[model samples]
Target: MLDRSSARDEVVRLTRDLVRIRSINPPGDELPAAELLAQRLKGFGFETEVVEVAKNRANVVAVLRGRGDGPALMFNGHLDVVPPGDLSTWSRDPFAGDVADGKIYGRGSSDMKGGVASMSVAGGLLAASGEKMKGDLIITAVSGEESDSIGTRHYVERNTLDGIGGIVIPESTSLELVIAEKGTIWLEVNTYGKTAHSTQLEIGINAIEHMVATLHEIKSKWESIGYAKDPYLSPPTINIATIVGGVKTNSIPDRCTATIDLRPVPSQEHPKIIRAMQEAVDGMKGKLKGFRGEIKVINERLPFATDPSSDFVKMAQALGPSTLGLPLDPPFGVNFFTDAAIFATKRSIPTIILGPGEYDLRRNIYLGHQPNEYVKIENLEKATRFYYELSRSFLK
Candidate 1:
C-alpha cells in the first residue's frame, strides 16, 4: 500500500492533469478529459463507454467486474467546473495546474477536479494491485454539473439503473462521508407594466417599482413558508441572486425581472414552493398599481435525501474511523446542491455528498467563478486515501 503522503503525490499528479483540461461548464470542453479518463480506465482493463448527450458535454462510465455475488459500487464525479473568474486574484495561473507550497493551485481544484483525480487514482490503484474483489467497481466522470446537470439527469432518467448497487458522489467532504444534500428550486419572476416618462410617473406604471415590491414579498413570504428543518443543516435559505430592470435610468421600464434561488431542505415540498411563490405574486398584484406579473417556476432540481442507516452509508462510515484515521460522525445536510440529488430523488437510490474538501476551501469563497481558483494539495491527498479505503471496504 502507498503511504498517505505518497498517495497524495500520485493524486496531485492526476488532479493536475485533469485541471489542466479546463472543462469549464458553459463550454464543457470535457471530451478530452472524458477520453483521457476512459483511456486510463480501459488501460486498467475496465469496461468503459462514453455518452455524449449535448454539444461539448459527455459522461464516462467505467466498470471493473468483480466476484458476481458481492454488491457493486459506483464512484461518480463531474469533469465540468465553474469558470475561473478574474485573473488578478490568483497567485499562480488559474489553468496552470501548478503545484506550489504543497498545494495544487488551479480552477476546479476543490469544487471537483480533485475529486475526479481521487476516483481515477482509486480505480487505477485497484487495477495495479490486481486485487480480487466480490463486486464490480463502476467509475463515472460526467459533465454539465455546474449547469442544469442535464448530463446526469438524462443518464438517470433515460437509461436503465442496471447492475449497480449504490453510488457515491466524490464531492468535497473534508475527509468525511456526506450522506445527504439539500434540494434546489429556481424561479424567474417577471413583473410587467407600462412604460412612462420619469417625471410623468402617474401616466404610466413603473414596472421596476412593482417588481421590487414583488421581490420583497417573495423574501418575506419565503421565510414564513414554515419549511421543515434538519438538525445538521442551517434553516432553509433563500437568495435573490439576480435582478434587472429598465435599460436606462430615465425611462419607467415596462418590464423588470428578478431571479430567485431557493435551497429547500428535504421536508419542503417542491410543488408547494411554486404555489407559495404564486400566492406571493398574487398578493403583490393587489398591493401595487396594475400589479400584472408572471411567475415561471422550473424544476431546477429535486431535493435529495438518503436513509443514514443504509448499508452503503454504513459501509463508507466503517472506513472513516478505522483504516483512514478520521473521525466518525453522522453525515449532515449541505445547503449547496450537487448531482447526488438526482440519485436519491429520481432513482430512489440513497446518495451521500461527502468528499475531500472542507468548507473553508470552497472555491466560491475565493470568488470561484470570479477569479484564479484553486484547492489545497494536502486536502486532495487526504481525500484520495478516503476513496481508496472506501473502495477497498467492499472487496479484496
Candidate 2:
C-alpha cells in the first residue's frame, strides 16, 4: 500500500529518471524517455504503446480502461525539451537530474518532466486504487513539442477522440490553469535585384535595401491591421527572426531574404493574414524599379480557446485549488503555443494547461529553458495530487 509520502517520493524519483534522459528537440530523440515512461505505466497495469513518429523519436501512450462507459480523460505532456546550451554555465549537470537542496535540476525539469512524472504517477495511483472508474484515463508522453509538435499531430491523426471528454496538458504553468493561447505563423520573405559591382551603385538595385524598406513599411502597420484583442491575451505581434543576402560586402547581390515570426489572435484567419503579408511585399513591386518581392509561409498553427463554463474547465478549476490549498487564479491566456492547442483545435477536445513551473521567489530558483533549470519537489508532489483529484472527477 502506497502512502501519500511514498507516492510523492515515487513521483520525484520518476521525474529524476526522466530528466536523466537527453531528449533535446532540434534533433528530437524521445524514444529513450518514451520507453522509460512506458515501463512505469505498464508496471501500473496500463496498456502502453510506444509510437515512433520519426526515425528515433517516439511518443508513449498509456491507457487504463474503466469497467463502465463514461467520458475519457487524457493527460498529455511532452518528453522532448529545448537544448541546454553552454553546459559550462550550469552549476550541475543538466542531464544528471540532480536532487539538491530539495529540488531537481535539469534541462527539462520545470519545462515539463516534472509535470509528465506527476501525470504518470497520478495515473498509476488511479490504477492501483482498484476503484471502478466510469471512464478511461489516458496518459500520453509526447515528443516534438519544443519544435513542430509532430508527435501530438501524429497522435491526433491516428487516434480517435470521439469518446474523449477532455484533455489535460501538464505543461508547466506554475499551477495556474491556461485555457487559451496565441497561434503562430512562420514566413519567409524574398527580394530580387540585379547583381553589380559596388563601384557602380546606380547600375544595380540593392535587394537588401529594398527588403529593408519593405519591412519598415510592414512594421509600421503590422500591429494595426487584422489585430485581434482579448481580455486575457496581448495583441498579436510580429518579430523578424532572420535575414540573409549578398555573397560579399563588395557585391550588390541579386537576392535577399528575411524570415518572420507572427503571432495571431484567435480571430485572425491564417489565409487572410498570409494575404495581407503577401500584399505588403507585392505592393513594393511597382514602387521600386527593377525590384520584386515574394512571401512564403513556412509553418502555421491556430490559436486555441474553450468555453470557460464547460464541464471540463469547471472540473479543473474546482479541483486544482481544492487539492493544493491555495486560491486558484482565473483562467488566463499565454503568449506561447503548446501541444494542447493541437488537441483542442484538431480533435475538438476541451483542453487545459495546468502544471508546476511558477518561480519561487523565496527559493531563488529560476524556471525552465535556461541554465540551472529546476523544479521544486513540493510543487511536483502538489501537481501529482492535483492531477489525481482532477482525474477522479473528470473520469468518473
Candidate 3:
C-alpha cells in the first residue's frame, strides 16, 4: 500500500527546498539543483548520473530499475526558471521559498519546481515500496528549457530511447492532460547599411529604414500563406520578439537586427517557412535600395501531438479522474511549447503534459513567469499522488 500522507509531506518539503535553490536560466546555473536531486535520488537507491552540459549547467538522470521485460516510462522537468524580473513587484522574496495561505511562494513554485519535486517524490516513494515493477522508472531534471533546450538536446544526442515506451512532462497544466502543443521557430533577421553623418542623409543608407520595409514585406508574405486549421491548436502566429538598431542618435544607423518568434501547427513544415522568409527578404531587396538583409534560424522545435486514441493517452485519461478527483474532460492543447517538442517528438513516444499549477490566462491565473508566482500546497500533494498512481498502473 502506498503511504499517501508520507508522500505528500515529502513532496511539499522537496518543492520548498528546490525553490530555495537559485537556478535562473539566463546564467543557466542548474548544477547546484542537479546535484541536490542526484543526492536525493541516490538516497532512494536509484541509479543516478549528473552530467554537466555547460559551465554551471547540468542535467540529472535517475533510474529505478525493475525486471527487464516491460517498457520503460520517463518523466522530465526542467531545473532552470526564468529570472524574477522586478523584485518590487513581488510581495515576498522570490527565492525565499516562503509558505503562506496554503501556497509555496517562489519564482519556480509553479513553473515548475513544484512539478519537479512532486515527480521526484513519487519516484522515490515507488522505489521505497519495493513494488517490483516490470519496467524502469526514469526521471530527468534538465536545464536550459527557458532559453533553449540545450540540456535535453544534449541528452538526446548522448542517449537512445529504444526501450522507453512513453514520456511525461510535468509542466504546469493545472493537473489537466495536454495531448498537443504548438511548435517554435526563432529567426533572426539582420539588415546592413553604410553609416554617415546624420546631416548627410543622401550619403548613407539607413538600415533601420530597410528593416522596416523588410518587416512589412515579410509579414504580408507570411500572412498570405494559407494553412489548414488544426482542431486541437489555435491558428499559427508570429510576433516580433526583439529589435536592436543604432548606436547613437547623432549618426545614421549602420545595422539593425530583429528576432521573430513563429508558432506553427504540427502540419506546417519548418523548411517551408524558412523558404518563405528568404523569399520575403529577396522581395525587399528588389524594391528598396541597399536593402542588404540576411535571415538566420536561431532555434526551432516541431509541434508535438499524441493521438487521443493512443493506448498511453487513453490510459492517462482513464486514470486521471480517479487519481486526482477531477473529471477528465475532453483533451485540449496548450499554446506554449515544452521539452516534449524535442523528447517525445524525436523519440516517437506517446507523451502527455499533466502537472500542478494554473496556466489559464483567461482566468487571470498566470502563476508562471509573473510576479508573486506560487503553487498551492494542496495541488503539489495531489500531483505527487497522481504521478505515483499513473506510474504504477502504467508499469503494471
- Highest lDDT, which number? 3
- Looking at model 1, report the run of 10 residues with the lowest lDDT sum: 360-369
User: For model 1, how does the per-residue alpha-carbon lDDT over 160-194 read when each residue is reduced to its tens digit?
Assistant: 76666778787766656566667788889998888
Model 3: CA > 4 A from native: 361-364
Which pairs of residues collide in candidate 3?
A: none
lDDT of 3 by residue, 1-396 (tens): 235657877788888898999999899899999999999888877899999999999999999998978999999999999999989999999999999999999999999899999899889889888899989999999999998889999999888887898899989978888889988889899999989998889999999999988998888877877788987888999898898999989899999999999998888888898899999998887798878999989988888988988888888888877778776557778778889988854578898898897676234355699999999888888888888888898887
User: If candidate 2 were superposed on the true structure by all CA atoms, what would the RMSD be?
Assistant: 2.3
| Residue 225 error, candidate 3, Å | 2.4
Residue 123 lDDT in candidate 2: 89
From the highest TM-score down, the ranking of the candidates is: 3, 2, 1
- Model 1 regions lying over 4 Å from their true place: 1-9, 361-373, 376-378
Error of 3 at 166 (Å): 1.0
What residue pairs are clashing in model 1?
Answer: 85-370, 85-371, 86-370, 173-355, 173-356, 178-353, 178-354
Question: How do the predictions measure up, each by TM-score?
Answer: 0.90, 0.95, 0.96
lDDT of 1 at 5: 43
lDDT accuracy of residue 319 in candidate 2: 78
